[model samples]
Structure formats: C-alpha cells, structure tokens
Target: MARPLRFRRSPERWTASRVHDQLFTDLDDNLGATAVDPTFRPAGEWETRRFEMDNDDVALFIWDDDAAYWMGNTETPSALWRTDKYDWGEVPYQVARWAQRELLADLHEESPWLEPYPHVSWFFLPVFMSKDGRHTTREFFRDHAAGFPDAGRDEGLGFYEEFLSTGVLDEYRDEMSGKLGTSPQFDLVRMSSAMAEFTAAKLLTDAGYQVTPEIEVTTGHSLDFRAAKGNHQPLVEVTRPLPPTQRAADTAVAAVRETAETKTSGQLSEHGGGAVLFVDCSSFHDDQWRAVRGEQPEVRHRPAVVYRVRPNGHAEGYTKGAVPLDLDGAIEWV
Candidate 1:
C-alpha cells in the first residue's frame, strides 16, 4: 500500500513581521510624500513618491507590490481593506505588510502551481498606504527584490504563516481533506504461476472473445476460454501461484521459459486462435513482479475505462491512465 498524501505544516518564523515593517518604512522613506495618490504617475515619479501616504493607501500599494513580485501580472483579485483610514497603529500595518511580502516572495520562488499575478500578490495590503508625515506618492522598481534565505526550505513555513494570518489554510483544509479522503482506482496486471490458466482466458477476452472459468478441454484440465469469431489457436497461457519447488540455479531461466512459452503459444494464426497462459501466483512472494510482455491485468477484472477515474473540477484528460496511479512497479505492455 502507498503512503497517504499529506500537506506538511511546519514551524513558524517570529522575525517575519519585523521584516515587513522594515520594508514598508524603507519604501516610504525612499518615496517621500507622494505615495498616497489615488491616481497613477510616471515610473520615475512613482518610485520617488513611495506611493501616496494614507495608511489604507499604503497597505494597498504594498499589497499590489507583493502581488506583482510573486505573480507578475496575473494574480486573482482579493478583497482590500483600508486599515490606514482608521487608527489601527503602525504595528498592525507593519505586521500585515511583512506577512504579505514574505508569503508572496516565498511562493514565487518555490511553487509551480501559482501563476504570476499581473500586478502585486499581497493578500492583506492594498494599492496604497497612508503615513503620518508624507502626502500620498507612488513607488515602482524595475527589478524585484531578492527572496528569503533557504527559500526552498522556508517556503512551506512562510506559506503556513500566511495561511494562519490570512485564514486561508483553515478555511480551505476541510475542503481539501474531503477530496483526499476519496480513493482513486487503477489498473492491475497480475502474472504468476497460479493464474496461467486464467491468463489464457483473459487474452481470449482481449481479442473480443469471452471465456468462463468452467470450460473443459482435451487435456483433462479446466481450460479458461470460449473463443468467439472461431479464432482458437491457443497462443498464451497465464499461470498464477508459480510452482514453488524450483532450486536457485534455474530460477531466472525457469521464469523466462514460462513466459516465453506463453508468448509462443499466443501467436495469432490464420484461424485466429492463439494461446496465452494466465498464471496465478497470489501465494508467491509479495515483492515479485509478474513478468509478461504486452499484457495488463484487469483491475478487479474491469476495463480501464470502468475502473479509473479522475478528480472532479479538473480539466478532462489531465490524467488519462488511472489517475493517481497505484502500481507496485513498472508493468510494460507492448
């Protein structure tokens, strides 16, 4: 059995908030007073103003910057609040900015799923910020700032912080968990000494014929077949529960001989009859792979279309052959 897929949450960082505060102040000091403007300005003037100075406006600006930093210009729109309009204190503003910047930066570097936001990717901040002394001005940089240390390792941590602060993680976890709870189906191909007779029957089915487990043949052994279209030339035999008495010397050759015999017997003839040995080795070693070329076992004896299904809300064809593939090892079918 495979291990369950998990969303590994990690420890948080305490200094992240401090980092946000520092960036906001640095941005404000560099741009002077024009950072609070509701209107847009030239690139040069925008950089000098650091976005017009309203706290609400400052949050919006930093938020926009963060979005731009991570998503480039394609981020989804999120609700923006004008905390700067109230007396929420500089601490709140700094904390919010810090969290947003860190999350965006981390995500941009580490995740493949996230698309670049056309503008900025900040979750809490807005397109503007209001400060005590300066008039609202704009701020823009041609190149983005660098990301955090060991960003690969820190990204999960950063995202978790953002999740807690933004409340996205808790709100989304239940939904994600429900989806994970559902198990996916896959194709199974079993080849062993015991199922050899069964394999012969299955190959007949593959060629558009049907076979029942009770059919008797000339050899006095129960043959697994009822060939249709008058195509009967005994081509392959699938055996399960391979005979366990073999010594170590011929183990490899014995298996090869068994497999080769099935293939040779399964040769399509003018009469359209072939033989395939279906061996059932269910009682054999768990780690063994049933080695057969161009053959796949039915998952619970159902066709791939009937057994495998993709997740809901995903684009069709994203997963074709048994989505969330559950296989012991590579099964070659030529």
Candidate 2:
C-alpha cells in the first residue's frame, strides 16, 4: 500500500492590498525614496524600479496600461516575466510567489513554478523552517517586530527567509506532489521497484540501446523494459536482490526465473528472440550475489540470459540452455 497524498495550506495569506503595501514598504526600506518614481505614469505607459528585499536586489515593474505589477531579480531581469500576468490588483500575490521561489532557490530547493491560484495560498513555509530555534520571518515579526506598521511584509519576508534557512522545501514538495506522495494511482513499493527498473533502462540507453520502460504484454504483466536495435527487440525484466537473508535471496531468484520463463515461453513463444533478466547486484557482495544467482533454473522454451550488474556499473552474463546468440556481447555492444 502507498501512502496517501497530503495537502498543505500556507500559513500566511496575501491579498491585493497586502501585496501593494508590502512592495512599497520593501521599496521604502531598501532603496530609499529616490528609487521609487513619485510621478504617476500616463495611461498605457509603464514604470520600473530596482529595489532590495532582505539584502537581495530586486526589480519592480508597474504596467499602467494593464494595471499589473512585475517583480523579479534585477540580475535575471526577465526570469519573473515568464510568470502568469498579474493584474495590478494581484501584485501582492505575485510578489509573495516570487519571494517563495527565490527563497527556495537560495536554500538549494527545487521549486518549479506551479500555476498560481486566486484566494488560495500555496506556499508551505513551516516545512522549510529549521527544527532549531532560528527566527523565521513570522517568528521575527511575532517576537521582535510585532509592532511593525506593515504586518504583511514581515510575514511574507519571514515565510521566505525561514524557507531558505530550513531546507525541507524539497521534501515537502515531494510529499505533496511527487509520484509516490499523495496519488492513489500508484503503490509506493511498486513505484520504488519501478525506479530501480528504470535505472537499468537508463543503462541500456547509455549503451546505445533504444529502450522503453514498462512495456505491456498480453500476459497482463508489463515487461520492465524493452530494448531494440534494427530488427532485434528483446524484452528485459529487471530484478534487484532482496534482503541478505537466504530465504529472501531464494525468493527473489525464483521470482525472476519464473517471470522470465512465463513471459518468454507464453506470449513471446512465437518470436525466436529470448528475453533478458537484468539483475542489479549493487547491494550484494560476491558471496551474496553467488547465493542470489544460485544454480541456473531450467527453461522450457526460448533461451534466457541472466545479466548481473555491479555497483560500479559493470555487467556479467550467464546463459541458461543452448542460447545460439552471444548475449553478453550483445548487451555490452555499443
């Protein structure tokens, strides 16, 4: 069974008025009065200003024609422009989003820009805060700057600052949005096992084999991967050894052998080409691998080749029955 996906709500919510006030507050605090143009823009004309937020230089743009605000880092001037257009009324939300993304970046977190929603705050701040008693933006304001004129600015800055300092943003994102997180469509253990299989598929790709992961077969079981070159297309099943216990090793080997026999001897019977069982033995030692490999099981129909991959990415092939082709050379080819 897989874990249920969890949804989180942002601790601080921002409205248009909140964003407007915060931007101006940031402008006043960082760049002083000269940076902001007191003169109003003519209809259809736009104005831009450079300011600082938490010591980082930022750019603020106001489009009078559309009544929108665009703010981003001055260094990557166009980076924030790619975000969805924010009406002047939505400037606060836009700034809040930008601050969150920037803070995640500073923390070395992978924060992809998801579609923004109105009235709903999506920033997950607590996940990014340290377990230690480090002051988050929220905490700073609550503790030291409680009397600040603009509470929204402090809250927004605190959320982002805490995110940068804590560094759990990635984990939070994964748990909330990653494949194995909240989705009920996939089993967690199955997804993890598939990842290992995909690793083998990646190796096949690196070896110049055109490989596809998770190819469905008639037997209702999907082949882990399928690799092709010219007219040769071989079904590949990837297996990783179980725990070091003898019973676990025996069970894993039997499962692999049974799968190979059933698939190749049944739906794949008409095709002369055999299937490959790629075993990832990275977790195993020589003795463990030898025990896991065990005595070669008998195959009734098409020849099967068992390939063991080492931790350092080397592979050794073992053949069962009279395999006419050079399976080892074929695997290592290219």
Candidate 3:
C-alpha cells in the first residue's frame, strides 16, 4: 500500500486577549504589569511590574475590545505586532520583510548578526524626570538591585574611569576584569580626520561667527558677510577649477577681491582683517576608498572630478572669505 499524503497546519497565534488573561491569572509570574506612572504600579512588590495605563493614567489591565482605538498613556495593544504599523487590524509582513533585509545586508557583509531572525527584548523600567533634570524614582529596590553592585571591579582602568563611576560592578568583578584585548580594526586615522573636521565646524559655531558654506567669486570680486564681527568681510572662493600645479595665486586673490567688491560694494571697513579663503576638497584618504570598494566594488572613487565656479560664484564650504576648518579639512567658520 502507498503512503498517505500529509498536510501541514498553520501555527497558532499568541493573541492579545490571551496575553492579558494570562497576566491577572495570578501574581507569582513575576512578570507582573504596571503602568508608566508611579501610582499605577504599587511602590512595593509591584514595583518592577510593567503595565499599561488607562485614560486616567492609572496602571490597569482592563482590556476594552470595543474601543478598537489606541490612545495616549495606554500600553501599545498586543495585536499591534500583527498589524502593518503593529496595529491590531493590519498585517506586519512588510515590516518583517524590512527587518529581515536589514539583517541580511549586515550579515552577508560578514557583520556581527549571523542569525536568521534576531529577537530584541526590552525591559522597561520607569524613569522619572524633573523639570530641572536631576530627579529619579524607582518602585522597588529589588527590581533595581541588579543595577547597583559591589566594588573593586576594575584592575587597570584608563581614561574610561573619567566617564563612568568607579568599581560599581565589583560583585561581578570576575566578569568585568580584563583588557579591551584589541583596538577596532577600522581606519582610525581617517576616522580621526573626519572627527577633526566635524569638531572644527562645531567650534566655529560656538565662536558666534556668521558662516556660509561655499561660494564662487570672480577675479577682483569681493564677498561680504553681513554680520562680520570685526566689521571685516572678504570674498570666499573654492579651488574647484584651480589645479595645484597650475593654480594661479594672483587669479585666486583677484577672484576673492572681485567678489568682495561686488557684494560689499564700497562698504568694506578697510580697518581690519579682509581676505579670501580658497579651499580644495580633493584630498584622498586611502582607507575611505578601500572601505567603499569593499562594500561596493562597482563604484570607483572618482578622484579627478573637478567642480567649476559659476559666474554668480555660488558654492559651498566657504565663510567670510576664510577657511577656518578643523583637522578633517572641511572648511568651517570661526
């Protein structure tokens, strides 16, 4: 006799009603529910319990299926995980697909997550905030007990001690003690350069200077900044069309002067500092090029692409006719 054909059945769903019913089924689950507010969950045994809040902001699990609506201060409905937006009525296939694709992209690139489906579990603890930003409240000491431990944890601590409190993880000293082992394998030099550029721009902003991105200036044309602190303004130009070997210093100077003349007109304060800054953003970092290629081999680094200055002299990466930039070399103000 031939074997009988077999059929597979769909999996059962963990419905919201089921989850809610299970919660009040009794206290020993330790997964007790509490509302976001202090009064929602009791200050004692219920301290660590997580719950959804009602309209009154009272932490209660009174489920109302008829309302069929989501409101502020309420726990997100369990059915939300099923919906497209994680709403009860919609399907979340698209969201699931996106999550999968993201995971795959990283994994295929030999990144950290190699598992097919990654699960993220969040433990929500109520955090209290005061208007002045210096107050905190917790429901129970036992629930927060893990956060505070013994002392003498770190052996050879370095600059990190400046950031975190010392020896707090002493109870878990065995797990905590150790060297960092190795530095990150990424290109630290290029990263440092990029960080420098960002820092420079930030410093300029802190200095209270009115800065502009990039602008093109013609020879003998001067650019003017409206709020030049020292009342001195200069035309700014970028060396897009200028080559290092054949760059004309006179032409560059003339272009800035012309920009200043056209924009500031006869208003230049002739009193203090007034000059142009011309920058070239063509520097090549071997690491960045290699990294990009490793990710996408088809896209070659275009080192020869040159930008041109228009007749209007509008561009980016210039301010007050000076390139006040940081280590990363991106021109900034200050």
Candidate 4:
C-alpha cells in the first residue's frame, strides 16, 4: 500500500525534455510505462500526457512550464520530485474532472465487473486506486464480499451498487469514501468498521430520512450520522459488534452489548442525550444474530436499535428504548 490517489505535484518546473526524460528514460525502462493517448483531453492551457503500464496502472501528467501534476495508480516517477499531495477539491475543477474521466475509463476496461456499478466505483475511485489502499480495497469487494458474511463478491457489490445507485448519499462521497482508510496495510476490522457507516447510511436512507454523516455536536464530538425529515432531526451513532469468532465476547448478544456500551459511554455520554444508537450486527452469522435478536439486551443507552442486514435487502431488529425515528419501514421490528 502506498497512499491515496492524489495530485503529486512536481517540485521542479516542467520542460518537454525533462518530461520526456522521466517518462522514457526512467519510467519506461524500469516501470514499463508507455505513453498513451487519453480518450478525452481536458480543454485547458496546460499540456497533458498519459502513461500506462502492462499491469493496468495508469498515470496522468498535467503540466505547463509553470507547474506539473502527476496522478494515477502507479509508483510515481522517481525523477519528478513530488511534494504536497492534493485532494480532488484542492486542484482545479477541470483537471479533477478530466483525470476522473480518463482513469474511470481505464478502470472499467481493466475490471469490467465494476462497470455496471458506476456510482459505487466513481464514489470510491480515490481509495480504490489509492497507493496504499488499492489492492486491499478492491479485494474487499472482489474477494471478501465487501464485509458481508456467507456471501460472494457479486452479492456484496450488487447490494451496495443498488443503494449507491439511488444517489441519496452521493453528496457526501469524498469524505465518506476516505473513511475506508488509505493506510498501507490490510486491516479487515478497521476497513469493515468504516463500512458500518455506509450500512447505517443505507438504513437511514431506506427509511426515507435524509442522511448526513459525521454530525458534530455541541459536546465537541462528531456523531456518526444525522437523520432528518422535515423538522425532525435526530443524531445517530452507529456501532458494529465483531462476529463471535472475531472477538473475545462469549456470545453475539454480549458482543453487541459490549460494542454499543463502548460507544454510548464515550461520545454519547458526553453529548448527554437525544441520539439514537444503531447496533449493526451485519458481521454476525445467522445463528449468532438469532440469539442476539431473541433478547434485546440493554446497550447502556435508551432509544437504541440492535439489527442485522442481509445482502438481499432484508433487515430485522429490536429497539431498547423509545427511538425517535419511525423505522418500521426500514427495519423489521422483532
């Protein structure tokens, strides 16, 4: 793992000979990268060139004599001194748009399975091609079923594809996708934990409530989500219990209780109230969830929900206290 897909600005000013020297002499010889024409060029004053490697890695260089920018999924050229990285928003809007289009085309061509799920791919392209998170992130969906148990990659990808296709949470794409983490190592628990936010977002959106994530409260803490419809606005904090095998908790219910308790006692405790606690047991097996569902144990917070969701779009749960949101449509009350 390297780093997130971002603008690696060149320290030295661009010249045609240096650009050619780097691409042909260094990248071509060592990295096997060859210059290729991009499908759609950005309409701008800056000169742009595209390079691709045999392994399907693509890099784009947008430069004028004044400055140069490098972006892609490969090892950045060693000759070009890369300094500060730029998030998508930090660069010129046209450059970001052009890079996204060019890379997305190459992305779909290499992994056709993802083409049908444009929204999901487009939303996560930053991390999906990130230097550190790329392989592991793609593997999560392509191999690990995107964190679903007892399911294959297609089911998991399709489940998210449908939800993301609705565009309900598209406005939050940049920050939300970054939550998946662009660290250099594969940490399933950490990555899966980030996805719990998406699962919660789907739940809130499916329930017809507008969902906004990372709501900072007066307590100087940021809650997971805010669900609103009309004048009704409720803060939501989501927690996920590891499956029985993954945690030391003796049982699934205990796992749920313990995880939720950790959350409630931390930020929610400081916030003092009016938040809904959503206990996501999606990682639990069928048997594990059934046992937890049998007893809606207290999670040290009222107005809390204990729930599990399946890839087929079915969810069931029980509420501990008077939940502010009417979730009958989104969850099957047990």
Candidate 5:
C-alpha cells in the first residue's frame, strides 16, 4: 500500500538543470509526467512546479536555496531522504491547501458520481485520493455499501455522508480517516472494522456528547473515545463482532457474546473498569441481527451497549448496568 503524501527532503542543492536531470526525469519515465503551472503564487522563496500525470498520479516539487521538498502521490526519488511524516493539518498551510485543491479536482473529475456528496468528498480527501488506498477505500463505500449487508452503495454512502457533514469529527480527521487504511487491495473485514469507529462516533454525538477520540490513559493505552456530556465524561471502547457465518461461533447470539468477551478481557480489563463498552452488530443482516437483539445476551462488561444499526437510520439495542450517556434519542431501547 502507498503512503499518504509527505515531504521528502533532498540533501543535494537544486539547480534548474538538476531539477530536470534528477527529479523530472524520474517522474516522466515512470509516470509520463509534465511540469505545469500551479496558478497560485507561493508564499515564500520556494519555486514550485506541479507535475500532473496520466492514470491520476501527481507530485509537487518545491525548492529554495537551502532545501528542496517533494510532496506527491508518485514514486519518490532515491536521492531525496524521507522526512518526518506530519499529520495533514500539521503540514504547511500553503502546501496542504494546494495539494488538497489539486487532488480534489482530480477526484471529482475521475469519479463524477461522487460530486454530489461534497462533504464526503472533502472529508475523505486525505484517504479517498491517497497514493494507493484511493481505489480500495472508495470501493469500500461504493461496492460494499460501507459494511451494510442489506444496503446499496448509495444507501451506505449517503448514511456516512450525513454523519460526516455534521462536522463533529472533523477536528480528528487525520486519525479517524486513516483508520480506514490505504491498502492497495480491497479488504472487507478490515474496512468494515474501520467504519465501526464512524458508527460509534455517530452514536456518541447523536446522544449529545462532545466526543474526542484516541484518549490516552494511565495504563499506557489509548481508549477509542471519551464522551463528554455536561460535566460527565465516560470513556468508551467499541468493538464489532464478525457475523456468525464468518466466525467459529455457531450462532449470532454466541458471536455477540464471544466478541464482546474478547474486549472485556483485554483493554477494558486492563483499564480496571470506568469505561463503557459498545458492541456494534451493524455487519449483521436482518435475520442474524434479530437473533442477537431478541436475546440481548450479556457482553461480560458493565455499562455496555449492544446494538445493531441499519443504513436507513434505525438503531436498536439493550444496555447493561447504568449507561452514562443519554442514548435514548438515537438508540431505541429494546
């Protein structure tokens, strides 16, 4: 899988001739790239050139008297040394904005079908147009229906587009979106697990809590989320069970219990309590989910929510012990 775009620093000093021999030669031979105008004036001493290639590949080269940086989706030159990878927001403002605009234009141009969902396009730009994760990530929503066994591509995309448009998790975009991964090949189980976080995030916000993700604790581990409502804050750890057919568990009920038990015994146990567990059964189809929901079996953890959600905006579940957040509005108590 290809990595997200980051700056690669070159030790060798740049000359106009050197840019052609060392940089342009590699990209042109590899991707048939051409140096073109970026249209925007750079903010500093760096002279910038944008290279656009066939098959949706691009790389931006920026250099000044002291240093040269390469940021793009193509093969990096061997001469350039990789620098520390910063989050998308941590990159320089001008460079980040420039890369975003260029990549977004390519995204819309290539996948015109995604143009309607502006929020989804913009929010997932980092991953949707990432070097190699682009096709696999986009296909997860388009073909897999975002892990809904019974939902169509549109239903799944629209469901997530709505939640993302709320901008509740926008601040944590890098961490949250990267969870979907950038594998070159398609993977259903892995991609679905990533969407589970999105589902969990929606539940947290809809239940009226200001949510922060990847919360660090004294145990030297990070909890999935921290849900804050008024003065109350509850740590939340979310997990999703494999459908009965995919796992060793014989029944859907058993699948729920078995999967939940794994989380309860691991991180939650290590934290020594004070966190709520969320077991999401969104991957279950109607009949499979009905079995789990009917029984509402114990997940072996206190203050836990066992729920199944549909792409059509319906969610129902049962809770154990006393749940800290007010989830009554979003989750129909069963």
Candidate 6:
C-alpha cells in the first residue's frame, strides 16, 4: 500500500534546477505521450507544455523564487497564475491536473465543446482528505493543526473549528453560494475578514454578551458584530487593517473612519453605544495609533470605543464619552 501524503511546509532551499527536474519527472509519469510539444527554456526561467484541449499552452514561471504556473491560449493568457508555494509538498502530477482543470474550466466558458473537469473551489482542495480517502471537518482540522501549528490555538482557527463541527460553517457556505454562485477561485481576503469577525463574536460571547454577526443596517452598511448584556448593547464593527502596500496610512485611516461613521449613523439610533474593533494585521506605527486614538473625539458618534487588536491577540485603546462598559476588564487584552 502507498503511504498517505501529508501537507508540509516548503523547504528553505528551492532552486530552479530542483523544480525543473521534479516537474518534468512528474509530467513524464503522468502525461506520457499525451503532453504535446513540451519545452524548457532556462534563459527565461519558464517551461511550456501543450495540452490536447484546444491545443492550449500552459506555462510555468519562476516568480519571486516560487513556482507559479498559468494556462491559456496563444492569443490571451490567464490573468491569475496559481502558485505551488501554498502546497509545496503536493505531487507535481496533481499540480498539473489542477492547472489543467482550471484551464479547461476557463476555456469552457468561451467554447462549450471544451469539456471541463468537475468544479472544485480552491479553498477546499486536497487539504481536507483523510487517510481513508474520506473528507471531513475533523480531517481538515487535523491537517490544519499539523500544517500550521503556530495558528493552532488562534481564535480564528477555534471559530472555524466550532463552526465546522456544529454545521454552522455549512450554512454559511450555503448562504455565500446563494449570494454568489460557484467560482473556481476563492476570495481569501473576504474569508479572513469574516473569520476575524467570528473571532470577535466568540470573544464577546465568552464575556457573557449575546453576540450577533453581520447585522445589516437600513443605510445599506453592515455591522460585523453586535454584543448585548443587560441594557449595554453596543454595535461593533470589526475590520482587518489593510497593509501599507495596499493603502497609505492617511487614506487607510480615512477609510476606517468613513466605515465607522456609516455603521455608527445607523446603530446610534437604536443601540446604546458603538465601537470599532480594528484587527491589526498591518504593522501600525506609533503615529498611526496616535492618529486613530485622536480621531475618537472628532467622531460625532458619541459613546464609542476603538480597540486595536494585535496579531499576538493583545489589544489596547480608549473609549470616549460616558459608556457604561469598562474597556479594560471587558475585553481580553491577551
């Protein structure tokens, strides 16, 4: 019996020569004579292989010292190229199949005669398989825990585990499917933000507050979460701070405030108070923190608090006006 392959971290050293050798070797075994006009060009650090479907060419490129591949025809190429860094230890044969599937799926949109493989969302790929070939949440959790031990105890991981185990995640998946039909790619950024909101909800629930997720307002803006205990009902907006590469400090801060105002405007009418929970993914400077802290008073939305939660789970900030809640003890700083 063949040993079950497990997901592992990428090796520290990945040279072009190693990738070239491994990729071609795997292709020889999987494709045989079916792979047409395959060629390797060392000068450009790329390789190309023609497939039977529409005689389309799929090319692999070395990007930032990582193996990345894209599939398309001679006239137009795929906008997005899938990378091998995400699943470094995955068999090259399987990688080829994935790229082929993606290419065929794209081509099928234009030419109905081109047969496409059964669609599989990128999020739930080969990662969810068990030793017995069964796919289960338990197996996914085990793989996740093994592959990413650092995030094993994270609140996001915990929330996902709970949701998967209790079937809430399936419902959420169905809701998303209803909103947006099936697609080949997954919006990882949006998913991460949702997970962050879920983490905040869990934290509030643990603190004895009844928490609600994704509350839509009459103003067409959505609050990430709402937590209520007794008469202290606070509308909470959870946001993952954008990296400096994506948005400048001034622009990011402005955007944050704008988002807060939209939510505050709607909730202030019904709720006792409002707060903004900024999940600090970006490495924020002292000036940025000061700017965020200073913005509280200017915010016309009174009785509002701003909390900046760090990657390590430590959080700090201030509350303005006469909010009945205590910021220090109410929130778990670490």
* Leading candidate by TM-score: 5
* Predictions in order: lDDT: 0.27, 0.41, 0.24, 0.83, 0.84, 0.41
**lDDT per residue, candidate 4, 1-334, as tens digits?**
4656788776567776777897646678777878867788886787888888876677888876567788977776676554678888777877888899987886687677888888889989988877677767877778778888999888888888888889887777778888888876777787778888888889888899999888999989999998999999999998888987898998988898889889988888999999999889998888998898888788999889889998888999999879999888989989
Q: Where does candidate 5 stray beyond 4 Å? A: 7-18, 29-32, 38-47, 53-56, 63-69
Where is model 6 more than 4 Å wrong at Cα? Answer: 1-189, 215-223, 248-255, 258-300, 324-327, 330-334
| TM-score between candidate 2 and the true structure | 0.39
lDDT of 1 by residue, 1-334 (tens): 2111111111222133432354345545544323233222323211211232332223233222222111111111122111122211222334334434533443344332232331222321121111211111111111101011112323422332332343322222322222112222211122112223322332334345434343454544443443443554332323332323433323432543454344334432212333333333322232232331212333221112111101110111111133222211212222
lDDT of 5 by residue, 216-239 (tens): 999998999999988899999999
Steric overlap count per candidate: 105, 4, 33, 4, 0, 0
> Could you give candidate 3's per-residue lDDT for residues 268-320 as a string of tens digits?
22322233323222221233223322332110111111111111211123232
Name the runs in model 2 displaced over 4 angstroms. 1-192, 218-221, 244-275, 292-294, 298-303, 321-334
For every candidate in turn, the CA RMSD to the true structure comes to: 22.9, 16.6, 21.9, 2.8, 2.5, 17.1
TM-score of each: 0.21, 0.39, 0.18, 0.87, 0.90, 0.39
Q: Point out the worst 10-residue segment of candidate 1 by lDDT.
A: 308-317
- Clashes, model 5: 0
lDDT tens string, model 2, 1-334?
Answer: 2222111112233344544465555555545422433222223333333344443433444433244444343222222324453321234444334434433443332222212211111333322222221123223323322112123434423433333233322323333222222222323233334334534554565455666555777657666666876776777766544334423334545645554556556555544445565554433345654654675454444454555543233555466555433344335421
TM-score of predicted structure 6: 0.39
lDDT of 4: 0.83
Q: Report the C-alpha lDDT of model 6 over 72-183, residue by residue, as the tens digit.
A: 2221122222222233224354444444344444434433321221222212322212122223222322333311223442432343354344333232332222222122
Kindly give the stretch of ten consecutive residues in candidate 5 with the minimal lDDT sum. Answer: 77-86
